[model samples]
Target: MTFGEKIFKYYQQINVPQDLPTGVEVLYPFDSTEVADLTRSFYMRYFNDKRPRTFLIGINPGRFGGGSTGIPFTDPKILEEKLQIPNTLDKRHELSSRFVYQMIDALGGPEKFYDSFYFTSVCPLGFVRDGKNLNYYDDKALEEALEEYMAGEMRKQLDFGGNEIAFSLGMGKNIKFLKEFNRRHNLFKEIRPLPHPRWIMQYRLKRLDEFIGVYRETLAPFMPDFHK
Candidate 1:
C-alpha cells in the first residue's frame, strides 16, 4: 500500500479512548471528518509516492498545533501558508511548528525535507487538562494507562519500514521512554535525541540559529542523497 493509504488506514483504526481521567480532554483531531480528510489529502499530496523516510517522533500534539491540524507539529497557519494545505481550524502559531519549518527550510524546502522524513508522535493523539496541553508523561497514571496504546501505534508505523533510526524530539522524558521501549521491543536501530523545538523556541530563543544548526548538523548524515 502507498504511504498515504497506510497512514490513513492507521488513523481510521485508531481507537481513541473517551474515558480519559475526569479533568482530561483527549483531542483526536483525526476523528473529525474535515480534519481527517485534510490530513489524508496532505499525505496524498506529499507522501503519495513511496520512498524511504526517517521517522521523527514527538511526545504528543498540542492544542493549537497538531490537535487543530491533524498533522504532527503543524499549526494551522503553517499548514495553509507553508504546507499549502488549507484548513478552517483556528489559525494559531505554534513555536514548535515555526522552529520545525525553519529547520526544514534550512535542510531544504518542505518538498525535499518531508520527502525524506516523516513526523509522528509517541502518543498519536493529544490531551488537554484544565485548558492546557498535557504530555503523556505529565501524570504517571496517565502514562501507564497509555503505554500499550502508544506501543501499538508505534508498531503500526514501524511496519512500514525505512524507519531505521528514529529521532526522539524531546531529550528528557520522551527519550527516556523511547530508549526503554526500544530496548524492550527493538523498534529502531537507533533513537537519536534532539532538543524539542518547543523547548528551543521557548528557552533558547536567543540561540535559535544555533539550535537550528544543531538540527542541521545532526540530521545531515542521515539525509537522503538528493537532500545532501
Candidate 2:
C-alpha cells in the first residue's frame, strides 16, 4: 500500500478509545462521512506515492482545524481555498493553518511541500476538556494513560516508512514530550522542534516572516529537488 492508503485506513478504522477519564471527550472526526471523505481525498491527492516523507508531529488537532477537516493543520477555509477541496465544515480560519500554509507557500506551495513532508500528531486522535481543545499532555493522568497508545501509533506510522528524523511542531511541552517519548522508545534518529504556529500567531504576529524563514531553512535538507 502507498503512504496515503495506510493513513486513510488507519483513520477510518479508529474507534474512540474506551473509558477516557471523566471530563475528557475524544475528538474522533473520522466517524462523520464528510470528514472521512475529505481526509481520503486529500491524502490521495498529495500522498499516493510510495516515497517516504518525514512526519511533522503536532500536539493534537484543535477544534477549528484538523478536528473538523481530518487533516492536520488544515482548517475548513484552507481545505476549500488552498486545497480546492469543498467541504461542509465551517469556514472558520485558524491561526496555525494560516501560518502553516504561508510557510508551505514559501516552500513552493502545497504540491511541492507535501512531496516531502506530512503533518500529523503524537496522538493521531485528540481530546477535549470542558468543550475546549486539550493537549494530550495537559493532564498528568491522561498523559500517562495515553503513553503506550501514542508510542504504539508512532511505531505503526514509522513502519509505514519515513525518515529517521522527525519534526516536533511545538518548541515547548510538545517537544519535551516527544523527546522523552523517543528516549524511552528509540523512535527516531532525532526529533527536531519547531515553534508552534499557534504560539507564534498569538504572540509573534509581527515577526511571522522570520519564523517562516526558520521553517524553510530547517526543512531544506529533506526537501526533494523539483521544478518551480
True-structure Cα RMSD, model 2: 1.2
User: Root-mean-square deviation of each candidate, in angstroms?
Assistant: 1.5, 1.2
- CA error at residue 114 for candidate 1, angstroms: 1.2
Candidate 2 minimal-lDDT segment of 10 residues: 13-22
- Candidate 1 similarity to native, TM-score: 0.94
Best by TM-score: 2
Model 2 per-residue lDDT at 187:
90
TM-score of each: 0.94, 0.97
Please write out the lDDT profile of model 1 over residues 1-228, one tens digit for every residue: 887778778787877854456688898777688888888988888788767679999999999888888889889999999988787888889999999999999988877777778899989899999889999999888887887778877888876555688899999999999999888777789999999999999999999999999999988677666444
lDDT of 2: 0.89
TM-score of 2: 0.97
